[model samples]
Target: MLHVIVVLAGLCTMGMAMPLPDFYSYSPEAGGGTGVMYSTAHEGHITGIRIWEYASAYIGGIQLRYDGNWTDLVCVNSGTPMEMLLVEDEFIVQVSGKHDSGYIFELMFVTNHGRSFKVGQPSGTSFHLFPTHDGSELRFLSGRHNGWGITSIAAHWAVYSSDNSVTP
Candidate 1:
C-alpha cells in the first residue's frame, strides 16, 4: 500500500512539471462550395505568412512559414501577394477576416508585438479569432479551398515553449 501511494504521488508531480498545450476552438468557417480539406502541420513557431488576394475579389492563396521553412501554398497563386515576417520572440496572436457565401474576402493577422498584417478587400461577414488562454498563440490552420481561392478557413492555437517546441 505504501509503494502504491508513492508511485501515485510521483506520477502527479511528473504531470505538473510539464505543461500541456491548449487547443482553442476553431473559428466559424466562412464561405461556400466543397473543396479539398487541408491542415497545416505544426512543426515550429510560425515566423511568417504570405497571402495572395484578388484586387477586388476574394483571397486567392495562403502560405505559412514555420521557423525558416515555408509550407506549400494552399491555393492557386493568381492574385497580388503580400507577406509578413516576424522577428524573434514574436508570434501571431489573432486572426480576423471577412468572408461571403462564395469566398474569403479579407484577412488580418495580429502579432504579439502589436504588429499586424491586413489583406484583401472588405466586403462580407467578419470573423475574429484568438486563443482562449493567455500565452497561447496561433499554431496552425485548417480548412477547405477551391482551385481558385480559399472557400473556408479556420485557425488553431496552442502554447509553445521558448524554442518553438510544443510544451510537453
Candidate 2:
C-alpha cells in the first residue's frame, strides 16, 4: 500500500509539470516567399491568437483550415482593430476606422454558409483573406499607415502527436 501511494503521487507530479502550448511568430521572408503562418491539418485546434501592429495598413483576410477544407476569413477596412476573438472555428473582430467605425466582422469555418459573414460598416473595399503556403505563411495587404499591418501573430494550439511538430 505504501509503494502504490508513492507511485501515484509521482505520476500526479509528472502530469502537473506538462507545459502549455508555446508561442510562435511568422514574418515575411527576406525576398518574399510562400509559407503558411500556421498549420494543424490533422493536428489540433488553434485556441487563441494575438496580432501585433507591424505597420499601419488594411487587414485583408485570414486563411483558415477546418476539418480538411480551407476558407478565407475576411473583414472590412472600416476601422482599426479594437479587439479580436476566435470562437470555435471562427475568427471574429471589431474595428473602428475613418470610414466606418465601431463595426464587427467574422469568418466562419464554412464559406458563405450563413449571413454572408459581413457586418460592421459597409464600404467599397473589404479586407481579403490570404492563403497559407506550406503551413508557414502569414498574409497581409501592402501599405503604410499608422495603426495597421500585422507585425506578428502569436497562436495557442495543441499538437495531436509529438512526432510531427515544429516550434520557434
Candidate 3:
C-alpha cells in the first residue's frame, strides 16, 4: 500500500508538469469568410445576403448584432467580411480572403451564460450551407457519402424538457 501511494504521488507530479495543448496559429488564411447566418438587431431583423463588393467590402467586419444599437455593428479588422443569414438571431461573417480559400465561414453562439459555441466547417471537403428559422440549426448540402442529401439538422441536442421549468 505504501509503494502504491508513492507511485500515485509520482504520477500526480508528472501530470502537473505537462505543457499546454497545441493551438492553431492565427493565420490570415486559417481565418476568413462570413458564414450563412440570421440575426436580430436594434435596427430590425437583417436577412438575405449575396457575395461582396467594394460598396460593402473590406470593412474589417460585416453584419453583426448587439444588445444596444446598430452603430455597435462596427467593423474592426482590415478587410471585408462575407455576410449571410443563418437564423433569426444569428449572423454569419468571414474575413474576405484573396484566394476563395483565404477566408472561411465560422459560426458562433453567445448563450445567456456568456459561453461561446462555435460552429465550423464540416469534415467533408465540399458542401453547401443555407439558413434556418432560428440560426441555431444549419441546413446543409453535402456528399459525405457517395450521394449526399439535404438536412436541416446535423446532430441532436435537447435543451428543454416537458417539465415546464426554466431552471437548469
Q: Which prediction has the highest lDDT against the true structure? A: 1
- Worst-scoring 10-residue span by lDDT in model 3: 141-150
Q: Order candidates by TM-score, high to low.
A: 1, 2, 3
lDDT-wise, the better of 1 and 3 is: 1
Against the correct fold, how does model 1 do in TM-score? Answer: 0.83
Candidate 2 residue-wise lDDT, 41-125, digit = tens:
2323333322221124323333344434433332223443333334543321211221222111222121211212332224322
Q: Write the candidate numbers in order of decreasing lDDT.
A: 1, 2, 3
- State the lDDT of candidate 1 residue by residue for 67-115, as single tens digits: 8999999988886789999999999999998888678899999999999
Off-target runs (Cα >4 Å) in candidate 1 are 1-25
User: Scored by CA lDDT, what does every candidate get?
Assistant: 0.82, 0.29, 0.27
Per-model TM-score on C-alpha atoms: 0.83, 0.23, 0.21
Candidate 2 TM-score to native:
0.23
Model 2, position 157: C-alpha lDDT score = 26
